[model samples]
Target chain A: MTPPPAPVDDFDLHGYVDHQLPPARREEVATYLAANPEAAARVADYQSQNQALGAAFEGVLAEPVPPAMLTRRRPWLGAITRIAAALALLFTGGTAGWLAHDSLLAPSAIERTVAEPAAYAHRAFAGEFRHPVEIWGDNEPHLVTWLSSRLGMPVRPPDLNQAGYWLVGGRLLPARGGAAAQFMYQDDKGGRITLYVRTGIIGNSESRFQFFDQQGVRLVYWVDGPVGYALTGPVDREHLLHAAQLAYGQTKR
Target chain B: MDDIAQQISEQIPHLRRYARALARDRTRADDLVQDCLERAWSRLHLWQPGSNLKAWLFTILHNLHANQVRKLKRALDNVPLSESHLSASTPATQMQQLEVKGITDALQRLSEEQRAVVLLVGLEEMSYQEAAKVLDVPIGTVMSRLHRGRERVRQLLADQGQPVLRRVK
Candidate 1:
C-alpha cells in the first residue's frame, strides 16, 4: 500500500551531487540514497572529485594576471603600465610627496584589490534569477547585524531609493582570507547592481572614487577609513557613478 | 581600454585556468589563451552584447584548443601517472600533493569530451545549461559526460593508491 519510491538513476545522482536539483527533488534524492548504499557511495566519490578538482586549481585564481595579456589586449592599459614603471623608478629615490602624487595619478594596488574581486562577484551573481542572495532585503535589520558582526564592523546597506534602486538583498563573500559583504539592488525593469564592501584594508587612509569600466560592467570604488567600497553594475559609467555617490553618501553618515 | 578589450581582459584569469587544466602545461596553456583573446578580438562584432560573455569567451578558448589538438594529432598528456611519484618528506603536505597530482593525472586520462565537461562543470562551476552552451552539446550530453568523467576520475584515483573518499556506511 505504500507508494513506490520515485525512480532515481545516474542523472538524478549527478544532480544530487552537483547541487543542481531543485529543493523538493533534492529531498527526494536524499531519501532514495538513504536506502541505497551503492548510490550513496557513488555520491561520495563524485563529491570528492569536485573537492579535489577545486583544491588542485584554486591557486590559479590567485596568480597575478600576466602583464602582457592586460597591456596587449588593451593598448590603453599601456599608459598605466608606463605610469607604473615610472612609479617603480620613483620609489627608489623619490620624495614622499612624489609618492603621494603618483598614487593619485596611477591605479594602485588598492584599486585592484577592491575592483577585481568586485567585478568577478558581480559577473558571477548578478545574472542569477534564483537564489541570488543568502538573505533577502526584507530582513534589513537582521542582515545588517549579521554582516556587521562577521565583518568586525558596523555594516549597513546603503539606501539607493533616491537613485531609483531599492535593496533586493545581500550575501557574504570570501575576500582575501577575510569576509566581504555584497548588497544587491534592483530598479524598475529589474536592472540590478551590487555594492561590495570589505574592512581592514591596510594603507587605506582615504581615497576618492575611482572609476573602471571592466568589460561592460562599470564600477566606482573608494576607500574610507578602514573599509573599501566598490559599486558595480551593468549600467553606464554615469549612472553607476550616480548610484555609487548615493552609496558613498549614505555610508558616510 | 575599449569596451570589448576591457571585457576580454576581465576573463583572462578564468581562460588561463581552464586552458591550464586542459593543456596541462603553463606555456602551452598561456599560448592558447593568447590565441583565444586574439580570435575573440578579431570577431568582436559577432559577440552579442548583454549575452553570456564568459560563456562566449570560453567557447572561443575551447575551439582554439580543439584546433591545436587536431594539429598535434597526439595524446593531450604524454606523461604517465607513474612519473608523478608521491614524495614522503612531509606527511601533511605530501597527502595533499599526492591527491592533487592524482587528480591531475586522472583528468588527463579522461576522453577530451569528458574532460571538457568535467572541467567546465567542476572547475569553472558552470551550471549544466551553461556547460552545454559552451561545449555546443545538449543538456543531456553534458550530464552524461559529467557522470562518466567524474566516475572515471574516481576510479583512476583509487587505482593510483592515493587517498580517496570512503563510503561512511
Candidate 2:
C-alpha cells in the first residue's frame, strides 16, 4: 500500500510555487495538489502572480543604469573630486568654509524665490525644442557677457560635458526682485537640465545644499555670497547633485 | 576589495527591480536603490567580506524603505487636510504589458508587511530562510504572510472583476 499521503499546508504550497521545496516534498505537494483542484488553482494563481511581477519589472533590469548608481567605477573618485575641488575653492576664496559653517542658519527667503521659479522655468523650457532659451550656446562669450551685465554679476554656465551633458543655451528671467539667469544643457539622449542663478543678500547665513522636488522636477539650490544657484532637472539625485557640484566649482568667485 | 565592488555592482539591477516592486513609484524606487547602494558602499567593511552581500544590501534597502514609510506616515498624520490625493496618479500608458497592470495595482494595495513578503519570495525569488533573514523575521511569519498576501491579491483582482491570471503546470 502507498505510504500515508504527507499532509500539505499553505507553507508547502507556497514552497512549491516558489520552488523552495526539496524534490521529495515538492513531489508530495504535487500529488496533493493533483488530488485537490482548488489547491492546484491556488498554486497556478501564485505562479502567475510571480510571473506577472517578473514580467512587469523586467524592463528596469535592461534599462541603462543611472550614472549616479555606478559606484563601482567612480565611487572614490567622486568623493576625492569633491574634496579636492572644495579644497581648491578654499584657497581661492572662503566659499568652502562658508558653505560648511553657515549651513545651520534658518531657512533663507532666497530659497522661496529661487526654487519655485527655477523649477517652473525648467519645466517650461527644458522640453521646448525650438525656443528653449533666449540665447543659444553657439556664442558662449556673448551669452555670458549679456547675462552677467543683466544680472549684475559674472554669469558662467558650467561645462558638464564630462557629465555627458552639453551646453544647450540660456535665458534671463525676473527673479528675487532682480534678473535671474537660466542656462540649459542636454544629453545625447535628449534629456535636458537647467541651472538658475540670481544674486541677492539672503540674510546672514547661506544654505549648504538644499533639495526640492516640484511636479517631478528636481531642484538643488544653495547660496554662496551674493549669488543663489539652483540646478534643476528630471535627473536622479546623484547625477543632479554631481552636476550641481560641478556648477559650484566652476562658478566660484 | 575591487571584487566586492564588482559583485555589488552586479546586484544593482536586482535591487532596482525589487525596489520598483516595493515603492511602486519609479522615482522613489530609484531613490531607494541609490540610498541602498550608498549605504552599502559606506559600510562595506562591516559586511564580514564574504557572507551574502545581496541579502545584506536588501536588508539595508528594506530598512530604509520602512523608515521612510514611517516618516511619511507621521508627516501625513500631522496634516489636517492633505493634498495627498493630488499625487495618487499613475502613468497608465507606460505599461508595456497591459495584462500585468491589474496584478501590479493589486500588489500595491497589499499591506506593507504582506507586500514585502510576497515580493521577497515571489519577485526576488528568495528562499523562505533568506527572505526571513532579510526581513529580520522568523520563517513562520514569512510563510503566513506569503499565503495571506497571495490570497488577498487574488481576492482583490477578482473583486475588481479582473480574471486571476492563470499559469498551467
Candidate 3:
C-alpha cells in the first residue's frame, strides 16, 4: 500500500485541533484524516500533547500557598532615614525642630501620586526606542546628582538586580505639586520596568502599596517621607507588584 | 467587598490554574498567581465594571509569563539550550512515551509566543478567538502559531522516543 502525500496545508488540521473549524469544515477535516492514517496519527499526537500539557501542572493549583507569601513587610525605611532625621534633630535644637521634623514625617495622601503618573510615564517613555530616559543610568553618579539637585534632596536610583531588574535610566517630568523623576529598569530579557518618584506636599495620609493598571501598563506605588515612588511595567500586575516592592525596599535604604 | 473585587476574587483559582500551566514549577506558579492577585486588587479601578474578568486575568498572567520567559531566555543565552541534552535522554513512562517532563522540556524550547498560543488553546481550552485576544494576536496568527507549535511538540515527542505502548493507527 502506498502512503498518501502529506496534507500540504494544515490550517484545517490546526483549526480542528484548536476547535476553530465550523461544523461543516470540521466534518471535512475528519473525512480527510480518516483516509490518511498518517494524518490521523498526527491528530492523535496533537490530542495527547494537549492532554499531557494540561495534566502536567494540574497539581500546582492544589498546593497551599506558603504562609509567608500572603503577607508583606515594609520597614518603611525607618532605620536609615530615622537615624539621619535624629542626627539632624541633634543639630537643629529647638526653633527649627518642628519644621525639620515635619519634613521627615510620613508622606500624605495628596503628596503621594503613584499609579496614574507612573503608568502615564511608562506609556510615554518605556516603548520609545530612541530615548527611553533623559539621564541614562550608565552615568550613575551624574544622574543621581542631577536628579537630587533638582528634587532638592539626595536621590539614588533604586538597585533592583536582586529582583532581576536593572536601573536603565530616568527622565524628569512634572507631577502634582512639583517635579518628578521616572527611573527605568531593564532585565536581561529586555523587559523594562520604571520607578517614578517625586517629592512634594500631599494632603492625605500615606498610601499602602497601592496598585493601578492603565493603558495596559500595571504599577504599584507608595509614598515614604518626602518621596512618592511607583514601579511601572507593561508586564502583568504580579511582576509590577514585586518589582514595586523591590523598588520600595531598595529605595528605603 | 465591592462588585469588582468580588468578581476579581472569583477568577483567582482559574488564574492559578493558568499560571501553574504556564510556569510548570509549583512555587514559581503560585508566586505568579499571588502577585497577579495583589496587583489586580490594587488596580481594581482600572477594570471596567461588567467586563470579562477571566480574560483580563489571563491577559495579566500572559504579561507576567512573557516577562519571565524573557528573563529565562536571557539565562538560557548564557548556557545555551542546545547543551541541555534533552534529545538524547527520554525517561521511562508507563502511560505514554513522552511524560510531563519530556512535554515540559519541549515546551521550554518553543518560543514564548508559540507556548502562549498552544497553552491558551490547549490547557485553557480557549477558542481561537479568545486565545487570540489573550495573546493580542490575530486569529490567523494564532492558528499558524498553534500549528507550528503543535507540530514542533509532535516532532520533539517523537525524537524523545518514550516507548508508546502501541501505535493505534
Candidate 4:
C-alpha cells in the first residue's frame, strides 16, 4: 500500500528534529507526529540510527595516546629549519667567493683610479641643500655645452622623462683625472638620483655593471662608450636600472 | 603531580572518544587528544576554574581535528572517497552490522560541515546552541544541516534496500 505522502514542512521538520523548536512548538510537533503513524516510525528510525552512529564512534574517545605523537615536532618546522641553514651556508659561500674574486681581479685598484671623480661628485653634494648644482635644468643647452667644454669630451645629460624622473640640475667637480660632471634628476616621490661621469684611463675598457651600497645609498656603476657613469640613489636596484636604461636610450638617440 | 595529572587524565578519555568520532582513526584521534591536553596544560590560565572543562577540551579537539582534515585534504588532492572511510574498532556483528555500516558509510558521504553537525548533535548529545558553538556556526545552520543530513542518511539506507519499519505515532 502506497502510504499517504508525508506532510513534511521542511523548516518545521528541521527545527522539530533538531530540538530547535520551543517547548510549546515541540508539543505541537509531537501532537502532529502522533496523528501521523508512518512519519512517527520514520522519526524513530532516524533516532535509532543517530544513536547507533554515535555509539559506534564514541569509544574512540577513551583510547590512550602513544607517547611518541605527543613529542613529535611538526614536519614543517624541521623542513623550514633545514632550508634556513642551507640559505645561510649559500650566502656565506657567495660572500667568500666574491671576496676572493675581488682580491684576485683587484678591481679596487682600477676603481681607485677611475672612480676619483665619482667620489669628488659625492663629496661636493654631501651637505648641499638649496643650491647643489651650478646650472639649473632650465638652462639645458648652456649646461651641456659648459660640462662638455670642462670635461674635454662630448657630454649629454640623459633625458629621463620616460623613466618618471625629470632633469634637476648639473654640477662640475675637480677629480683625479680632470673635471668630473654630476647631473641630478628627481622623481615624483621626491627621490633624487645622480649620474657621475669622468674620463676613463684604466686599461679595463669592457662595459660592466656593479652594485654597491654605501651608508644608506645604493650605486650602480657601469662604463658605456668612453664615459664612466655611476648611477647612485637610495632607490631600489630595479628602479635604478629602469632609470639608467631610459637615460642610456635617450643619450644614444 | 597526582592531583593535577588526575584531573587532566580524567578528561583524556572523553577527549579521545570525541577525537576518534571526528577523525575515525585510533592513532590520529589519540594524537589529537594529546595535542588538546598539552595545549590545555600550557594554557590552563585561560580556563575558567569551574567552567565545563570537558566542553573546552572538546572544542580544542574539534578545532585540531578540523585543521588536520583540511591539511590532509590539501595534501591528498583528488583523494578517492572510499579511502577516507573511518575504520571503527567495533566488531562487525550481524545484528547491528547493516545499521552500523550504513550509518558510517552515509556519515562519510556528508560534507565536513554536515558531518560536524551530526556528530555534535546526534553523537555528542549536545543541544542545538552547544552544537552550533562547537561547530562555530549559527544555530539555524546547525538545525538545517542536521535535518538535511538525517534525511540523506535515511534515503541512502533506504536505497540499500533496508527494511522500512512503519512509524508509530
Candidate 5:
C-alpha cells in the first residue's frame, strides 16, 4: 500500500517553481510533487520552459563576444596616441616622444589601499568558523566608537535593514598598512554579507562602483570622498549590490 | 590584457548571451553589447576590485536596454520561430521542436518587464532577488512578473491542457 502524501499548506509553490526555496523547503516541494501528479506536471512544464529558453539562447554564448565590444577602449586611446605621435614626428623630426603613460598607470598609495584591503579582509574573516567579527553589533555605539577610533575617523555602522540584512556584528581588520572596519549582516534568509569600511584612504573624490566575484563570494565596492566601502557576500551579484547600496546610503548619511 | 581588462573581457560572453535574449536580433544584440562594453570601459575606475564584474555588466546592459525601449516606443519583440534548425524527420522529434519553439514564441509575446524577468530567472538562472537587483525592482515585483510570465508561457505552450511529452491515454 502507498503511504499518504505530505501537505504543503504553508509552502510557497511559486517559490518552488522559481527555485528560490531553501534546501529543506525545496525538499518539501519535491515531496509535494511525488504525491500530486498534477502539480508534478506543472513543475515539469515550468522546467521545460526554462529548458527551452536556455536551449534557444545557448547559441549566443558560443558566438564570439563581438570584437567591437572588446576593442571599444582601444580606439579613443589609440586615436589620442596616434595624434600625439603624429604631432611629435612633425615637430621633433623622428625623436621619440614621452606619452606620460607612467603617471596615468600608477596607483596612488591611497588608491592601492582602498580596494585591496577590503577584499583581503573579506576573504580572511568571511570564512571564519568562529570570531567572524571582533566587535559584535550588540552595542552599536561601542562598535562604532571602537572602529572609528582605530581608523582615526568617525565611522558608523551602516544600517542595512532596508536591504534585507540586519547587523550580525562587526570586526576590526588589518588592511593595507592600516586598520579597517568590517560590519556583518544577515537577512531573514540565511544569507550573510559584510561591509568593509576603510576610512581616509583616498582624497575627497568619487569613484565608480565595481563588482568582483572571487571564488564563490560576490563583492561590490566604491570609494567616496575619504571613505572606501566594499560589501561582500556569498549571494548573487544583485543581492550583494543591494546590500552595498544600502550600506553606502547609510554611511553617506 | 591587463588583469582588469581580462576580468572585464571574461564577462562578455554571458553579456552577449543576455543581450541576445533581450534583443532577439543578432545585430541589435551585438550593438547592445558593444554599447555596454564601451560604457563599462569608460567607467572602469568606477568598478570596485574583487567584486562581481558580471553583475555590473548586466546592470549596465539592462539600463541601456530599458532606455532604448523607452526611446523606440518599446520595440521589444522576437523573430518568429522557424523549424529550419530541425533536420530530423521523425514525428516525435518534430513535435518536440515545435513545442520548444512554441515556448520561445510565447516568451517573446510577454511584456518587456515580464519577459526580462523570465529570461533572467529562467535562462540566466538568476535568483529572484538577483533579477530584482538587476532590474532595480523589489523582489515581490520580480516574483509576480516571473510567476505571471511563466504561467503565460505554460498556457501558450498548452502545457496544462496538452501534455508536452505524452498524450492523454
Candidate 6:
C-alpha cells in the first residue's frame, strides 16, 4: 500500500501529459502512474484543461476576412500614385508657368526640390518613424548657415515664437535639380516640420506662391528672386502658409 | 488566379473559428482575421509553391496578432489572476459540470504568448516542433508556456471547487 516515489523531475510529468516520450519511456511512466493515483489524477486534470482551451480558440482558424477590409488597399500605393500624377502635371503644361514666374516662385523648381520633404512630412505625420528625417535637429546653427550659403540667399531659421514647434536642426539634401537644404523643426509632442530650399532659374520672372497637399502633409512654396523656398509639414494649410509667410517676412527684411 | 483565390476562400471558416477562440469576441476575431488575410495577400509572393499554405497563413496571423497586442498594449492587465465561481442555474448540478465555466474563464486570463502556445499544441493538436515554428519560438519555450498555462488553468478550476477527476492509472 506504499505510494511510488514522486517523479524526480517535473519534466517527466509534462512529457507524459504531452505524449512526448519514446514508447518505452512512456510505458514506464504509464506503469508508474498506475501505481500512483494522486499523480494520475493531476495529469488528467491537465489534459482536460488543455482540450477545453483548444476547443475555444480552434474556431478562429476558420473565420473569413470581412469584405470591407479585404477591399482596402495599401496606403502607400495611393500616395505613390498621387506623387506620380503631380510630377506628370509639372512636366507637361506647368513648365511655362514655371518658367515665366520668378525663379523663386517657379512651381516646377520648388516641386522638384520639395517633393521628398513633403512626402517625408506626410509620412512622419502619418506615423512612419524609421526614416522620418535624414538628419536630427540637434545642429541648428550649422544647418541654417550651411543651407543659407548654398541657396545664395541669406536664410534665417523661422522663429516659431507663437507656434508650439522648436528648431531641431537641419541637413543638406539632394533635390531633383540641384543640391537642396532641409531645415528640421520639432514640436513638444515630437511632431516635425521640414523646410526645403534650392536655387534655380525659370526663364527670368516674378516671384509667386504655390500650395499643395499630399497625404495630409501641407506644402507651401514660393519663388523669391532667384531662390525657391518650400515649407513641408503636417500643420493645417493655413498654419503652414502662415509659417511660410513669416519666413518670407524675416528673410525679406 | 481563381484557383489561388479559391484556396484562400476555403480556409476562411477555420481561420474564423481560430480567431474567435483567440479573441473570445466575434467582432474582434473577424477584424483580426481580415487584417491577417490582407497581409497574406500582399505578401503572397513570399509564399513558397506547394507548401502547407494553411500553416503559413496561421504563422502570419499569429505574428500579426502578437504585433497588435504589443502595439496596443492589450495584454497589460488581461491575464486571469484569480478563480471565479461559475454561476449556478439550479445548484443541483454535478461538481464536474459546475467547474467547466471557471476553467474557460481561467483560460482567457493567460498571457497572449501562453494562450497561443496552449491553443496550438493542446487544441490544434500540433506537435511541439510544429507549434514552435508557427509561434516563432523555440520548442522548449513552447513546452514551458504550455505547461505553465495548463497548470494555471487547473489551479484556477481547483480553487473554484471543481472536483478533480482521477484517471484510472
- The order by descending DockQ is 2, 3, 5, 6, 1, 4
Best by DockQ: 2
lDDT of 5 by residue, A1-253 (tens): 9665356642256678667788887887888778889888777777777777777778877886656667656546755765664565447532212222211221222224544455556556665657877777888889888877787778888887777778878888765445678887766744566787775432226555655432232456776765678776566545566677777776773
Give one digit per residue, the lDDT tens place, for model 3 in A11-78: 77767876777887688688888889988888777878777766676665566655533443233553
What does candidate 2's lDDT look like per residue over A85-193, in tens digits?
A: 4465468653223232222222323444665567667767876768998989998899999988887667889998877789988998875345788999987767777
- TM-score of each candidate structure, all chains considered together: 0.51, 0.59, 0.50, 0.46, 0.49, 0.47
**Roughly what TM-score does model 6 have, to 2 decimal places?**
0.47
Question: iRMS for all predictions?
Answer: 19.0, 9.8, 11.7, 22.4, 19.5, 15.4
Question: Residue A98 of candidate 6: its Cα lDDT?
Answer: 29
Clashing residue pair totals per candidate (backbone < 3 A): 1, 0, 7, 4, 9, 28
- Candidates 1 onward: DockQ, in order: 0.12, 0.20, 0.17, 0.10, 0.16, 0.13
Worst lDDT run of 10 residues, candidate 4 chain A, spans: A96-105
| Pairs that clash in candidate 3 | A109-A204, A110-A202, A110-A203, A110-A204, A111-A202, A238-B35, B97-B162
Q: Is candidate 1 or candidate 6 better by TM-score?
A: 1
Task: State the lDDT of candidate 6 residue by residue for B1-169, as single tens digits.
Answer: 6677778777777667666656554554665677677778778889887987877888987886665445323211221211111121223444455555565567567778887877766666677877888888888898889878878877777787775333343
Kindly give the stretch of ten consecutive residues in candidate 3 chain A with the minimal lDDT sum: A103-112
Candidate 4 lDDT, tens digit per residue, A1-253? Answer: 9664445565566567556677866777788888988778667766766666756775555455466333434446645654554455356543211112111112343344334335445545633668868899999999999988887667878988876778888988765535678988876755566788764332335565654432233456665544567776556546677777776666541
| Window of ten residues with lowest summed lDDT in model 6 chain A | A98-107
* Candidate that scores best on TM-score: 2
TM-score of chain B of 3: 0.76
Q: What is the per-residue lDDT of model 2 for residues B112-151, given as tens digits with 9 covering 90 to 100?
A: 8999999988888898888999999999999999999999
Question: Cα lDDT for residue B160, model 5?
Answer: 30
**CAPRI quality band, candidate 4:** incorrect
For candidate 5, what is the lDDT? 0.66
Every candidate's chain B TM-score: 0.81, 0.86, 0.76, 0.75, 0.76, 0.75
Off by over 4 Å in 6: A1-9, A19-21, A54-253, B1-7, B74-100, B163-169
Q: Sort candidate 5 into its docking category.
A: incorrect
Residue B157, candidate 3: Cα error in Å is 0.7
Candidate 6 C-alpha error for residue B65, in Å: 1.5
